[model samples]
Target: MKVHFIAIGGSAMHNLAIALHKKGFEVTGSDDVLFEPSASRLGKYGILPAQTGWLPEKITPQLDAVILGMHARVDNPELLKAQELGIKIYSYPDYIYEQSKDKNRVVIGGSHGKTTITSMILHALQQAGKNFDYLVGAQLEGFDTMVKLTQEAPVIIIEGDEYLASPIDRRPKFHIYKADVGVISGIAWDHINVFPTFDNYIDQFRIFAETIQPGGELIYSETDEVLKTMVDGLSVDVNKLPYSLPEYTIYNGITSVLYSGKSYPLQIFGQHNLLNMEAARLVCQNLGIGQADFYTYLQTFKGAARRLEVVGKNDNATIFKDFAHSPSKLTATIQAVKSQFPNRPLIACIELHTFSSLNKEFLDEYAGTMDAADEAIVFIDRKTFGQKKIEPYPAEVVKNAFANERLLFFNEPALLLNHLEQLNIANSNLLMMSSGNFGGINLIELKNILL
Candidate 1:
C-alpha cells in the first residue's frame, strides 16, 4: 500500500506512519516542522521527508491513500492537492477503523483516564502473552509503538479520544471506532472551544455508546453519576457492565487491592486508578482473560507516561508529574496524593496550559479542585494568552474562581521555581500537573533539588 501523511510529526500520526511502515506499506510523510523524537524516529524508519513544509509535488495520484492529522489545517496545501486530484483522504481514526474493521475493537473513552485504562489492558495482554493490535495515546513502558497492526491479531485496543479526528473530520475520534467492547471511565465537560456546553460535550459519549456493534458490551464507571444517568438512558441492545473502585487499602503510601481473599499490591494508586483498573479488568474479561490472570499481570504495571508518573523520589520527598489540565483530573490527582501521604505536607502545582483550562469561562469548574493540597499553586505563562489569542485575566480572577483562600497564582516561571526552591521540602510531596511544560521549566532539575 502507498500512503502519504500530512502533518506527520504529530505524536499519534508519526506512530501510525511507523506502524504502517513496519507492516510493509510504502509510507511517506511531511510536516511544516518536525520536533525532536518524531524527527529522529521518522528518520530512523527512512520515511522522514527530505525537507520541511508541505510540497504539492508530494501529493500524487499514485498514492493509494492520504491520512490527515489534526495538526494539518483545512487549507493545508498538500490536503488541497490531494482533494484536487480526487484522492481518498481519511482522518487518522477513520483510517484506523478501516484497518481494524475485521478485528474485534475495544475502545476506552472518557474525558480522562482513557489512556491509563487502555495502557492497563495492553500491559496485561502483553504479560499474558496475548497477540493483539493496539493504538494507545501514550508511550507505554513495553510497547514499541503507540500504533500497531498485524493480520494475525484478532483484536485491537483503542484509546478513544473525544477530540476531533482531523481538521476536515469533525466527528469525535471515538465515534469512528464502532467498538465491540466500549468503556467510558467518566464524563466531564472539556474542549470548550468545540462543544461549548457540558450537555453538548456529554452527547458525544452518548453517541459513542450508540455506535457500538450490536450485542457488544458497554463497561462504564458506576460511581460517576453523570455517566450512570447516561447509561440508564441508553436504549441500545449492547450488554451493560458497570464497575466501581475496587476494595483497596493504603498502608505507608502503598496501596493493595483485596480480592478473592487475597491482597494484590499495585505499583499505581488512587481511586481514579483503581476505577481505571476495574474498567480494564472488565474489558479484558470480555477478551477472554480471567480475573486472577488480570490481577497477577497488573502488579507490574507502572502506569502510562505522564499519568501520575513518579519523576523523582527520595527518603524525604517524592515528586510526581501528571498530564492533568482538566478540572476533574486536577481534583482526582490532588485527592489521590493527599490520601496516600496524609501525614506529609502536599505542595501541588499546576499549569494553566490547555485552551479549556486557560479560558476565563471554564475557570469556575476548577472550584476547590486543589483544596486537598496543603499548598496549591497555579501557573499561567503570560505569553500563552497571546498565543491562544485570548485576553489575559488577572491573577485575582483565577484566585476567586478557585474559591480557595490559600491558592497562589503565578505569571512567571522563574518566580514560581524560586518559591518552590525556598519551600521546606522535608517530609513533603510535590505534585506537578500540566498538559504543557510549566513555561519550559526544567522539572528534572527541580526534582533533584527538591529531593
Candidate 2:
C-alpha cells in the first residue's frame, strides 16, 4: 500500500507512519515543522520530507491513503489536493480503526491511566506469547514504535484518547474506534480548549462507553464516584464490568497485590497506580489471561514514560519526573511520591503549562490538590500567559485559588531553580510534574545539581 501522511511529525502520527513503513507499505509524509525525536526517527527511516512545507504535488492520485494528523489545519494545501484527487483521507485514529476493524480491539480510555493500563496489557500479552498489535500513546521500553500493525494479529490493544481526531474531524478519537472491549479509567476534565465545559468533556466518555460493540465488555473504575454515577446511568448492551482498588500492601516502598493465597510484588506503586493495575487486570482477564499470570508478567513492567518516571535516585534522595499538569494527575502523582516514602519529606513542584492549567477559571480546581506534599511549588513561565493571551495574575491570586498558605510561586525558571538548589533534598524526595519542560528547565542539570 502507498500511504502519505499530512502533518506526520506528530507524536502519534509519526509512530503510525513508522509502523506502516516497517509493515512493508510504501510510506511518505510531510509536515510544516519537525522537532527533536520525530524528525530524527522519520529521517532515520528515510521518510522525512525533503522540504519543510506541504506540497500539492505530494498528494498524487496514486497514493493509497492520506493519514491526517491533529496538527494539520482544516485548510491544509495537501489535504485540499487529496480531496480534489478523491483519494481516501483519514484522521490518524480513523485510519487505525479502519485497519483493525476485523480484529477485536481492546480500547482503553480515560482522562488519565489509559497509557499505563495499555502499557500493562501490552507487556503482559507479550510475556504470554500472545500475538497482538497495539497503538499506545507513550514509547514503552520493549516496543519499537508507539503503534504496531500486522495483518495476522487477532487483537489490537489501543490507548484510546478522548482528544479530537483532527482539526477537520472534531469527534473524539475513541469515538472512531468502536471498541470491542473498552476501558475507562475514570473522567477528570482536561483539554478545556477543545472541551469548553465539564459536561462537554464528560459527554465524550459517555459516547465512548455507548459505542462499544454490542457483545463486548466496558471495563471501568468502580471506585471513581463520578465515573460510577455516569456508568450507572448508561443503558448500553455490553457487559459493564467495573473494577475497584485491589487488595494490596506497600512495604519498604514496594507495592504488591494479594490474590489466591499469595502476594505478587509489583515494581510500581501508588493507590491510583494500584487502581490502574486492577483495571489492567480486569482487561487481561476478559482477554482469557488468568489472574496469577497477569501479576507475574506485570512484575517486570517499569512504567509508561513520563508517568512518575524515576529520573535520578541515590541512597538518601530520589527525584521523579511526571506528566501531571491536570488536577487529578498532579494530585495523584504527589500523593504517590509522598505515600511511597512516608518517612521522607517531599518537595513537589508543578508546572502550569497547558491551556487548562494556565487558565484563570480552571486554576480553582487545583485547590488542596497539593496538600499531601510537605513543600508545594508552582512554576509558570511569564511569557506563557502572553502567548496564551491570558492576563497575568498575581501570585497571591494563584495561592488563593489553591487555598494553600505555604504554596510558593515562581514566574521565572531561574528563580525556581535557585530556590530548589538552596533546599537540601538530602533525605527528601523531589517530584517535578508538568506536561511541559518547566520552561526549558533541564531535569538532568537539576538532578546533577541536587543529587
Best by TM-score: 1
Candidate 1 per-residue lDDT over residues 195-217, each given as its tens digit? 99999999999999999999999
Question: Model 2 clash pairs?
Answer: none
TM-score of each: 0.99, 0.98
Question: Model 2, poorest ten-residue lDDT window?
Answer: 433-442
In candidate 1, stretches whose alpha carbon ends up further than 4 angstroms from where it belongs are: none
Measured on C-alpha atoms, candidate 1 has an lDDT of: 0.94
lDDT of 2 at 418: 88
Q: For residues 1-451, what per-residue lDDT tens digits would candidate 2 score against the true structure?
A: 9999999999999999999999899999889999989999999998988989998899898999999999889899999999999999899999999889999999999999989999999999999999999999899999888999999999999999998898889999999999999999989999998899999898999999999999999899998888999999999999999988889888988888999988999889999999998889898898889999999999999999999899999998899999889999988988898888999999999999989989899999999999999999999999898988999998998899999989999999889888988888999999999888888888998889998
**lDDT assessment of candidate 2:** 0.92
